[model samples]
Target: MVTVKAVVAGSFGGPEVLALVDAPDPVAGAGEVVVTVEASGVGYVDIMARRGEYGPLSVPGFTPGVEIAGVVTEVGEGVDGGWLGRRVFSQVQGGGYAQKVLVGADSLATVPEGVGAGEAVAIGVNGLVARIGLERAGVGRGDSVVVRGARGGIGLMAVQQAAALGAEVTAVVSRGRPDDRLEEFGASRVVPSAEAGASAEYDVVLDTVGGAEVGAWVSRLRPNGRFVLCGAAGGAPDTAFGEALLENYHKSPTFIAFSLGSLPGPAIVPQAQVLFEAAAAGRLRGVVQEVLPLAQAHQAHRLVEGGGLFGKVVLTP
Candidate 1:
């Protein structure tokens, strides 16, 4: 009998709820493929889902991971046999915290030659979010952009992508000195979170951390500026930022809440391909802060929740 090992969340609460367990192996169904997972990423979103904060993933008994990279080992009916040995990565609804995972065949992205499985998951998923958010906000050369939570994975990518596009990027860290690498990553200036909304007006603000500060940042938007919310690791805004948003309505300020899930599967394939090639060419950088065994998923969750990591924490099954 075939069995699969996975980290299961028997109940939603803290990291303690996650346990490594064995289950009957899953088989690929029509339009699905089974991937032998190499590395999975742990992020603030996983922490939120584990704590029942994320509505769609609040259910118990589910494995909590979305960023996955692996080799395709099995294909379902109608799937191309060429996928049997391809290295791939994807973002799924759940079940990535396992030795193998079943995913839709259409969702797979080929991993480039030079990118490791860990780097694929780290850069692929976060970079996709950053790229899409920046594009949606119409950021371009010479735009003044502020990226909140710029030291973490997605924020770090946002900083790099915006700068690469010629935007004058300001990276806002939660506290303390910003990493020197953030500047190297293309941040023109590094500011503490408290200071990001102080004086400077920006053409675009990409917010990953949400709080009362969102209101302040909205007030700092220049005419025709865009404020894009990609994630809210700091918790949702409790302030009445709408009034501030309305104050700039005549100036044509744009507020956009972006989520990668809103996109179709086909939309990600080309983007992933570009990202993989960029990483391969050293144009894109991914930081894998730590790699832990699958059984230590609880520890991985704790580390992500505790914050201050410059990159991503990966779990190898």
Candidate 2:
């Protein structure tokens, strides 16, 4: 069997659990294609997997990356021969931190011309989460939207996408020196999370960093405004559902949870394709802060957990 180098989690713990090892090159089964990956996204979900927060590790030595950009090397049974040499990006369910990965042909999004591999990887999960969350929250022209964790990968994308849609964007970032990248992404204003109460009332709230802030921000929305909760990076808080409902119904606001895993597969593919086009057109901005080799996957995780990076991190094999 031909083997490929990959980052595998030997156990559920911390970044130290991620090990670089040689694994058999994944084969393209029927209706699938094998890609020779140039870059893979290192995201919060990967960190969660490393800490065993999402669920039990499916395999002891399983690869953990969920998104990759690569060139198709082979097509499986029932797949078109034309796809064999195409450059594509995919949101794989797993097994992406390898020199090669197998994915369903239907899941592959063709990378647009002139888009760099690192940019494509940066747009992976973060872009999808932002697109879905903002759309679900009904963000559009003249609307005011608040984005929690504005300096984060998904948060930055949400800020850009919302602004492009003509919404007034208020970015709520952790207290510190402001991130110039947030303004570059089109945020109308940046405020410390502690000062979030001072932000103008918004039509929509994209809460990528959940916790006490959820309740505080939920109370800040205008009547009938929508709040989309995307991540718990700030730490999930135990809020009283009764109080939340009272605030929603009495205040005419709506609360919706956003997760790519919960959405229908067909729904996600088209959105991803749109993002790829937007990236190619220069309308979408994806900040890639670091690109580390596959052997340094553990260090990459540590950086992600340490939480000051302003953009996506790509792991190259």
Q: Pick the candidate with the highest TM-score.
A: 1
Model 2, 87-204: lDDT tens digits are 8888877788999998888888888887888898888689999998888887889999988888888998999999999999998887686676688899999887766664468889
The lDDT of each candidate is 0.90, 0.85
Model 2 misplaced regions, further than 4 Å: 56-59, 264-266
TM per model?
A: 0.97, 0.95
What is the per-residue lDDT of model 1 for residues 1-317, given as tens digits with 9 covering 90 to 100?
A: 88999999999899999999997798999999999999999988889889888876878998889879999999999999999999999888888899999999999999988899999988977899999999999999999999999988899889989999999999999988766888999999998886654778999999998877788889889999999999888889766888889877887899999988788766798898888889999999988889999999999999888888888899999
Q: Please list all clashing residue pairs in model 2, or write none if there are none.
A: 224-252
lDDT of 2: 0.85
